[model samples]
Target: MNPSHRLSTFNITTLALGLAFLYLPIVILVIYSFNASRLVTVWGGWSLRWYFEFFNDQAMLDAAWMSLRVAVTSASLATLLGTLAALALSRGADFTGRTLFSGMLYAPLVMPEVITGLSLLLLFVALGAGRGFWTVTIAHTTLTMCFVAVVVQSRLTSLDPTLEEAAMDLGCNPARAFAAVTLPLILPSIAAGWMLAFTLSLDDLVIASFTTGPGSATLPIRIYSEVRLGVKPEINAICTLVIALIAAVIIVASLAAKLSDARGESGAPL
Candidate 1:
């Protein structure tokens, strides 16, 4: 074989192995979610008993509901604020402290979650604020916004500046021009950012634990507590359900994006 062909084969083999390494644990968890045996190691038989048990566990259900609420609310707020920040940062002329501002925006992305959580907790206590749903929401939004901003900024970077200029030349006001011209182009990035924020918020556990109040415990926190007591098949079932839901959302989003792309290329004006 040629050297290039050998290199291609090596790259493909590396990619497949990397994917398997990342996904093997998830595959095991999904398979064991349906296991009838309480002991995770011993797969007695295929059964849906764990799912039934998860449904019957009211506290776990309540925690899941709380987590869903927090995740949706926080992610939405984060996406909105992050989009605005991205637009400003992307469009604005270079100014004093611009570097500092950018660094601050991205700091949470690299900061240790434990440190962030503890710092927020301390700040809240210092300000006489209580730990609850709102606290968790704020913390989630702070971290999630960084991700959304990064995604949006990347999309904005790829956008043609001439689109905005053309809209302005067509007698549309600045606000109207952006609403008509720029918004459509960057919408996919905004949506992708929102989805990422949602996933991150839903998966967060360390920060939520430090910020949550008595009644504001999220699903992950509940699962962590339960696992500490004893590993339950119901936990596995809940995780599997969450994984399925996220997967479905991603697939639907992908299909919708593809459809939109096809429509855009069909000669109909966007």
Candidate 2:
């Protein structure tokens, strides 16, 4: 075969192997979620007992609800704040300390979670604020906002500024110009950022553990505590359900993106 063909074959092989390496554990976990055996490795028979047990467990259900609420609230707030920050950073003229401001915005993205948690805990204590759902929400928003800002900045970088200018030329006010011209173009990025923030908030354990108070346990905290005792099939089942839900969200988002692209190409309004 030609050298180019051989290289293509090698690339394909590498990609397949990489995907398998990443997904193999997920496949195992999904399969074992239905296993009847108490031991994770030994599959005595195919059964849905674990799923039933997971559904019937009130603590798990409460934790799941708490996680959902926190993720939704934090992601929404983060998206709003990050979108504004991205617009200001991307569109505003250069000013003093711009670089420092940008660095501060991204600081939490690279900072260790332990340090962030510790700092926030101390700040709360110093301010006489008690840990609870609001504290956890604030912690999650701070971390998730960095991801939102990055995603929004990337989208804004590629956008044409002429649309906003044209809208302004047509007598549209600044806010109206953004709503009519800028917002539509950058909506995909905002949506992606929101999803990233949601996922990050959902998966967070360290910060949640530090900020959450009694009766405010999130799903990750509950799962981590349970795993310390020992692994259970119910944990596997819960994970399987979460994985399935995330998969569904991704698929739906992909389809929606394709539709949006098709509409844009057809000169239809979003």
Candidate 3:
């Protein structure tokens, strides 16, 4: 065989294996979700029993609702704060403690979730703040904002400051200039940040487990507790639903962005 052809075959094999390794478990979980029997491994034929059971599981349903609320609120707050931090870091002049600020902002990205969760737990306890829904929200927002900031900062660094300057030159104030020019350009990045934050908040188990109180257990917390009792078809159903939702969001966003880009390219002057 030709060396290049052999190398191409190897590369294709590696890629196929890598993708299978990553996705095979999820695919199996989704398939098993329809199993009629309680046993996860033994195929008892296809049925919607587990999905139906999942909907009827009141505790899980409530936890899902709570998780949704936490994700939306945390993602929004994180996007807002993260955008501001990104703006400052990417645009602001050199100042005292700027280095420290940058380091602290990105620290959570690399820090162990356990350490971050434990420290937050301790801080809440020392502050006498009650641990519940809001505690979880606060904790999630803190953890996800670092991710959001990184996303937004990447966009901001590449953004043209001249656009904002032109808006100012056109008799716009700083805030108005941003709203009129900068915000529109960065809106996609902000949306990306929000989506990232939402996903992180929803999938988080460690930080949430540390901060959540009895009544405020998120889906991951509930899922963890159930999984400790051994695997269930209902758990598979839950995973399927979560995966589907995330996939749907990604698909819609990609299509919308593609359409927008197509329009922009069509409208551009030759």
Q: Judging by TM-score against the true structure, name the best candidate.
A: 2
What are the per-residue Cα lDDT tens digits for candidate 2 across 129-168?
A: 9888899999999999989999999999888889889999
Residue-level lDDT tens digits of model 3 in 1-270? 876666677798999999999999899989999999989999999999999999999999999999999999999999999999999999885977889999999999999999999999999999999999999999999999999999999998898899899989989999999997788678778888998999999999999999999888999999999999998889999999999999987888788777767876897799
The 10-residue segment of model 3 with minimum total lDDT is 1-10
Off by over 4 Å in 3: 1-7, 263-270
Per-residue alpha-carbon lDDT of model 1 for 130-192, expressed as tens digits?
889899999999989999999999999889989889999999989999998889888888889
> Candidates 1 and 2: which is better by TM-score?
2
Error of 3 at 70 (Å): 0.8
Q: Residue 168 CA error for candidate 3 (Å)?
A: 2.0
| Clash count for each candidate, listed in order shown | 0, 0, 0
